[model samples]
Target: MSSPTLDDAKRRSTEKLDPERDVETLELAPASEYYVSHPFMRKLLSWGVEARGILPVPREERTDTQYNRIFFIWLSANFNILSFSAGSLGPAVFGLGLRDSCLVILFFNLLASLLPAYLTTWGPRLGLRQMCLSRYSFGFFGVIVPSIFNLASMCGFCILNAILGGQTLASVSGGNLSWSVGIVIVSVVSLFISFCGLKFLSWYERLAWLPVLLVYVVALGIGGKHLINPPPAEPADARTILTFASTIAGFVITYSPLASDFTTYFKPDVPAWKIFWYSYLGLNIPIISVQCLAAAVVVAVPTVPAWSDGYADGNVGGLIQAMLRPAGGFGQFLTVLMALSVTANVAPTLYSFCLSFQVCMPFLAPVPRYVFSVLATAIIVPLSIVGATRFYSTLTDFLGLIGYWASAYAAVVLMEHVIVRKGRFASYDLRYWDSPRKLPTGLAALGACALACALIVPSMDQVWFVGPIAQKTGDIGFELAFAATAVFYVPLRHLELRFRPMV
Candidate 1:
C-alpha cells in the first residue's frame, strides 16, 4: 500500500522509454521542494500537459466529467480565430453585407461544425489520435494520405496563427515592435505550452479566458452603439453567395480533423450527444457572434484602414484597433489581451501538428514529443513571416485546400461510423492498425478523396490553381464534393466490409 519509491518510478519510466516500441514515458516527476520554491525550472520546462500520445489513457487517469470539460472546450474557441474581423470574412470577401454575412456565417458555420461534433464522439470511445483512427480507414502505411493533409493543415494553423500573433503584438506596441519580433515571441510561448504538454494547455485555457473575455464584452458594450446604423448592403449574385458560403464552410471544416484531439481525455461513457452539442455550440456561437459583430463594424466604419504591410488591407487588427481607439489605455490593454489570446490558440494547434507527425511516423515516436513541437514551430516561424503579406488570400486558399480533403475524409468516416461501424470501434488495437492486410485497404477513402479533389479542382479558384469551370461559372461547377463522397463512400465501404475476413 505504500507509495511507489522514486527509484521505482524512474525504473518504470526507463522501461517505457524503449525506442523499438512506439512509446514514451509521459509521466510527470514530482517537483523537488527547491525547484518548487525557485519556480524558474518548472516555468522553463512547461511543468505539465506532457502526457502520453497514442497509448490509451488508462481509465483511472481519465479525469474530466462531461459538463465541466465542455466549458474548457468552449473557452478554447474564444480567440482571434473567432475574432470579429476573421468571422466577418465569409461575407466580406464576397462583397456581402451585414445581414447576408451573418446569415451565411450562421448557415455555413453550423453546417461545417457538424463533422467536428460527430468526430468528437470518437475521442473518448477510441482514446486514440485521429491519425491513428485513420489507419482503420486507410491501412497503417496508407494513413500517410490523410495524415499528410492533417499535418499540413495543422502546420498551416501554426504559420498563420504565428503571423497573426506577430501582427497582434506589433499592433499593440504602436510602431516600435516589428512583425518578425512578434512572431518569435508568439512562437516561443506556443512552443513552451505545447512542449510542456496538454496538462499545461488545459490549465492555461481554463484561466486565460478571464482577461480576454472581459475585454471582449467591454468592447462589444462600448461599440454596441455603432452597430445601430449599419452601412448599405452590397450586391451579390448566386455565384458570389455560393462561392462565399463554400469558402466559409471551408474555414470551419478545417478543424474537422482536430476536433477530437481536445476531447480524448473525457470518460468513455460520455454521451455522444453531449459531445456533439458541446463542441458544436462552443465553436458556432462565438464564431457567429464575432462574424455578425464584425460585419456590422465593417458597415459602420468602412473607411477604418486595417493594419497591413504599408497599407490598410482591411485586416482585423486595424478594425479592432479602430473600435477600441476611442477607449485610450483600455484599447492598448485589449490589444495585448487579444494578442495573448492568439498565443493560446497557437499552443493547441502546435500540439495537434506534432501529434499528427508522431502518430503518422511510428519510427519517429522514439524521440520525445517536445522535440517535435520545437521542430514544428521552428519551421513555421519563417513560413509565417513570408505568408503574412497576403494574409487574407493565404488564409482563404489554405483553408479551402485543406477543407477539400477534410470534407471528403469526414464524409467517409461519418458514413463508416454510422453504417459500417455503428458508433463503435475496436478498442486500442495497434495490431489492427500496424498491419495493412488487417485493416481496410483504404480504397474507399482514397477514391472518395480523389473524387472530391477532382470536383474541387474544377470548382477551385485560388492563388495556386484556378479551375476553368470555376473561372467561368462562379466556381460552382454544380458539384457538392462532400455529398458526393458521402454517397460514394457508403457503397464502396460496404463492399470493403464484406471482405473484412479475407485479410
Candidate 2:
C-alpha cells in the first residue's frame, strides 16, 4: 500500500505469471521476467503450454507438416457449405424469377469467400493469427474490438446452428425428443469434440463429407427426375428475386469472419491460384448446387410452404419429404443423413468459436480455452432451444449490422499490404505478436472510415432505418447500407492519412 513498486505494477497487469506455482503447470512462456514470476501468468501459461498442440503453430514452421495443407483446404471448403439448411431456405423466401439473383450470389461468394482466402494466405506468409493480422487495419489495440465482435458473431451462429440441429432432431424423432433435449445433446457432443481441438475437428471433417455427399447425391438423383419431367413453374416476381439475392449474400458474408481461421493453416508456398480454385470449387459450387436444389424442390412441391413462422422453415425434413416422395421411409433415411451433416457442421463451428475466444486470454491458456468452449456451448444450447427462431432472426440482423465493419477490415488489409505498405511485414513480426508502436494510425483511420460508412450507408436507403424514414422507403435497406459503407471508407482513409503521420 504505501507505494507499489514498478515490479508490483507490472506483475499485477501481467496475468500470466506466478512464482509460487509449479513450473510444469504454466502453458505459455512469459512475456518478460516479471510475467514469469507472477502467479496468474504462470497458471495461464502452464495451461497454454499443455494445449499448444491444439493450436496451429506460428506460420513458418507449420508448412513443414503435410497434414496442415490438406486439412486446412478441406475444412475451409466444407464448414459453411455442409450446413445447407439456411442456404436452401434462401431462394424459397425470395422468388426465383430474377435470373440476376444467381449473379449476386456468385459475386457475394467471391467477396466473402475468395477475398478472405487471399487475406489468410498472407497469414501463413506472415505467420500470424486473424486478430494479430488485423492490426494492419484496426490499430494494435483497436483490433481487439473487432476480434470481440467476430468472436460474438461466431458464438451466436453456433447457438443458431444448435437450434437448427435440435429442431431437426426433434422433428425426426416425431417429437419424442423435444428441441430442448436435442440442443443439449448436440451442444455437449460438439463441446467434447472441440475441446480436443483442431486435429480432432480435422479428422471429423474428412469423414463428415462422405455423408454430406451421399445426402446430396440422393436428393439430386430423386429430385432431378422431377425437374426433368417438369412441374408447372411458380410465378416469379421482381421483389422475390431481390429478396433471394440479398438473403444469399447475407448468408455468405455472415460466415466470412471465419475465413482466415481455416486458411491460416495453408502453407505459404501454396500457389494463390491453387488456393482460390480449390476454395471456389469446394465451397461455392457445392453451396450454389444446394441452394438451387432447395429452390427447385420448394417450387415443385406445392404442398410445402417455403416460409413458416415456426422452426419448420423448409428444414431438412421438408427436403426429404419433397425429394423422396415416391420412396417409402425415405424421409427417415434423409433425416439421419441430415443429422450427420449437422454434426459435421457443428464440429467446426464450435472449434472456430473456441479459437476466437482464446484470443481474449492473456496469452495461450488451454484449460480456459476448453472451459470457455464448453461453457459457450452450454450457454448457447439452452438459449437456442427456447429461442431458435428468434435467435436466427436476431443473428441475421446482427451479421448485417456488423458486416460493414468486416468489409472495411478486408479493404484496409488489402490497401496496406497491396498498396501502402506493399506487403513488406516480416513473418517474425507476426509471430512475436508485438506492434512497432503502441498504436497504428493507418488502422485507426480505417476503423473511423468503417464507422462513418456504416452510418451514412444506412441513412441512404430509408428501408434500413426503422423510424418514419424506413416506413416511407421499403426493402432497399441493405443496398443503401452496403454502398454507404464502401464509398465512404475508401476516400476517408486517404484523407485521414493526409492529416496524420504513420505510426
Worst 10 residues of 2 by lDDT: 17-26
**Residue-wise lDDT of candidate 2 within 93-125, one digit each (tens)?**
444522343454556565566555565455444
**Cα RMSDs of all predictions?**
6.6, 7.7
How much does candidate 1 score in TM-score? 0.84
Instruction: Give all candidates' CA lDDT scores.
Output: 0.67, 0.52
lDDT tens string, model 1, 1-503? 33333344334432233243222222424322112222453354454435355543433354567444544654554445335546656555667877777787788788888887778777766556677777777666767778888888888877877777777778777779988888899889878888776667777776776777676777778777767877677677766666666666766776777777877678666777888887788777666776677677666665433322212675566556656666889888887777667666778888878777866787664344566788888899999888878788777666666667787778777777776666445423433444566878888778766766667778876657778767766554223567778878877777777877422
Q: What are the TM-scores, per candidate, against the unseen true structure?
A: 0.84, 0.75
**Top model by lDDT, which number?**
1
Return model 1's CA RMSD, one decimal. 6.6
Q: Which regions of candidate 1 fall more than 4 Å away from where they truly are?
A: 1-51, 303-311, 426-431, 463-479, 498-503
On a 0 to 100 scale, what is the lDDT of residue 258 in model 1?
73
